[model samples]
Target: MADIADPRAVEVSRSATGALASLSLAMLLSSLSTSIANVALPTLSEAFSASFPAVQWVVLAYLLAITALIVSVGRLGDLVGRRLLLVAGLALFSAASLAAAVAPTLPLLIAARAAQGLGAAVMMALTIAFVGDTVAKERTGSAMGLLGTMSAIGTALGPSLGGVLIASFGWRSIFLVNAALGIAAMLAARRFLPPGEAGQDRGATRENARFDMLGTVLLALTLAAYALAMTLARGRFGGLNVALLGMAVLGAGLFLHAEGKIASPLVKPALFRDPVLAPSLAMNALVSTVMMATLVVGPFFLSRALGLSEALVGAVLSIGPVVSALCGVVAGRIVDRWGASAMVAAGLALMAVGCAALAVLPALCGVAGYAAAIVILTPGYQLFQAANNTAVTADVGKGQRGVVSGVLSLSRNLGLITGTAAMGAVFAFAVGTKDIAGAAPEAVAGGMRFTFAVAAGLVVAAVAIAAAGGLRKRRSA
Candidate 1:
């Protein structure tokens, strides 16, 4: 096949830097939006005179919307123009942020949040895809690495920033601030990004474009069902949970079957058939599971078991992302030198060791030990994320980058839901109480050990997968 990259694509030296900065800002904005509302949940609940569970939907709605729509929107970007979709998404996100800021009721706020999620899904799907589209192949690692750094910084800053904003201005200010940031990013994108190329293929046109609507619906159903099932499972597993799981499985099976038969499937079946892409994706999923599990469980362990304040727990939790941001630029450069597979294996090994340390050291060493464990864990995760992202796209074709990016996003989301549901279940069961206030310290400690061990085991499995994938790629080469 002839190169599908735009003939008019700007040289890396000419415009790549500004383009990267714009994309990074978009990434930071989207990532920050994901977690910023978390800190304001209590405030929102109080302001609206709503129950906690109902207010929880404010977060859940955004997540579910993003997860469900990302794949479809990504494929759409490939059919249409990524730049056009990106700008549209940013506009929508900004408008939704405004709507959310002025929402008079909890329901309206949740609806606006969902709208923001839809826009975020578009931006998330294309941010990395655009990197591949715009930057030189040789420098893709560096671009991806910096992108990861922005994500880390955004995630790490969300809670702390939200807390400060809420303290000073109130919960509405959070969405208002997002709106301003979104507008700035949108403007930056417009100024820096190249005109969208619908597709590099000569035959690409709206008349010829055939979106796999059935596959899109099936995929969306699969993700939504699974996400809902996991969310419900976090509370309790029952008949409805069983039904949702069954539906998810059915939807997944149908999606696969449809993809295999369809001409232009949302996710290309051949991509998964490739040894590198498949294993890279699996590794990404596993690593995300470990990361999210720690994020969900760590603060609880510190607060309940060690009697740490919320501020102290936030500081402890911030350690990983802070370290990730610090290491991301360097890690990207290292990936350029050493290749992604080696770095990924090393990263997984480091994560395993860190998780192991958390599993054992917390009981003996206490809060300081927990902090030390995170110090070890964060760098490994940052390294793994950068390398794994590079690895997934290394062999992907230009035309397929959007869907591939979507798959990567999907993997991370699945991992997030899985880690939260599975690890939360184990922790709750181990502690013998869902209510942390009543849980005994010994029980909480035991739960923490078990959870970390499980996380470590997951990382070990990821290491094996990475090794096997690397060997396979070497043989193929």
Candidate 2:
């Protein structure tokens, strides 16, 4: 075990290995639940005799719930206690999975999914928060990297796993699988994770411990509005989208106002003022947006532009996540050895190179080029995630870890929602067609190049921000 050299850091309440396993399972379960149901959308539609849009809610409900509640749940964990809440969250996720599996109606399934997402929100937030408790500060990157790897494995394994499960035991098997995993995670967490009382902020008192529920509600509503604005429109922003965006803007104003007045705010707006955190959040959002673009663009490019079959497209597309899973642990070790700030810069620089390569190389060299670019880009992403998460969380006070982790996760989720609409729109516009599925191969190729060129620019901006933040830290020091 790494030495606990930092005065504030302590050995875990139980075995670190056991705690890590529980946390890893939590991360995997949340991520797996996100993507697993997507492959079953068609089956759900047929089973429920529902329209495609209606069945789509099975996926969207979970995402929407997780997006809306992630930050608030994190803050809640801080006020109440992360360990107990994490256990409860695991139980809720497990029960909800079973509910979803047994739901006879489409609406019931959606409700179960939303509940499952609520539990996932807790899991996603607290798992990261618990890292400081479970590992030495010196090894934060490795723990962060391990979580990232589990996340990548879950994401990469989801569709393929779901496909296999569905073929063997029908659509219900997917939810059932998560149910089993959630049970195991809960048991391990109950046995191994430290208690909620142990990790509370040093100076905190019950008098000041009241949760800012109003602020949480306001933020959740505002985020839900903004997320809906980005998601519901798909590639097109119509009247509903504009109205939701307006609501989001108005809600943000109200939330800011409410937070200023609340005795215990859900998030201290002042936290964003920290040099390391401010840029880290922005960088996370920007990098997440670029990463999401690869998912948005890859399938269309592989199938339409390169004329690959669906099976081949799936196989090729899996490469990115596979790279991410393989690289996450190694990247974390590098961060521990080298330092987060430098690794952050190196990772962003590598991502920039990868994105640029993707823009040009794929168009010129096809599958080999696409594969090569993904190999570079995915590791860079893992490196950035491990370093960025380590940097952001390490700088925060212990009491704030849950809330900060939530906010960081929130930024990434928002970026993903934004990328789904914005990047996809960019690709569509570049291709010069509203009907992307019907567009010619050449148009698709040109679109892929242009879209990733934009992504590369985003990464360059992130690199500049990271450099600036590092400079600011030195001057402040």
lDDT per residue as tens, model 1, 169-250: 9999999999999999898888778876775432334554577799888988899999999997365888998899999999
Which residue runs does candidate 2 get wrong by more than 4 Å? 1-14, 196-205
TM-score of each: 0.94, 0.96
**lDDT (CA) for every model shown?**
0.86, 0.91
User: Which structure among the candidates has the greatest TM-score?
Assistant: 2
Clashes of 1: 0
RMSD of 2: 3.2
Specify the highest-lDDT model's number. 2
After superposition, the stretches of candidate 1 with alpha carbons farther than 4 Å from their true spots are: 1-14, 200-208
Number of backbone collisions per candidate: 0, 0
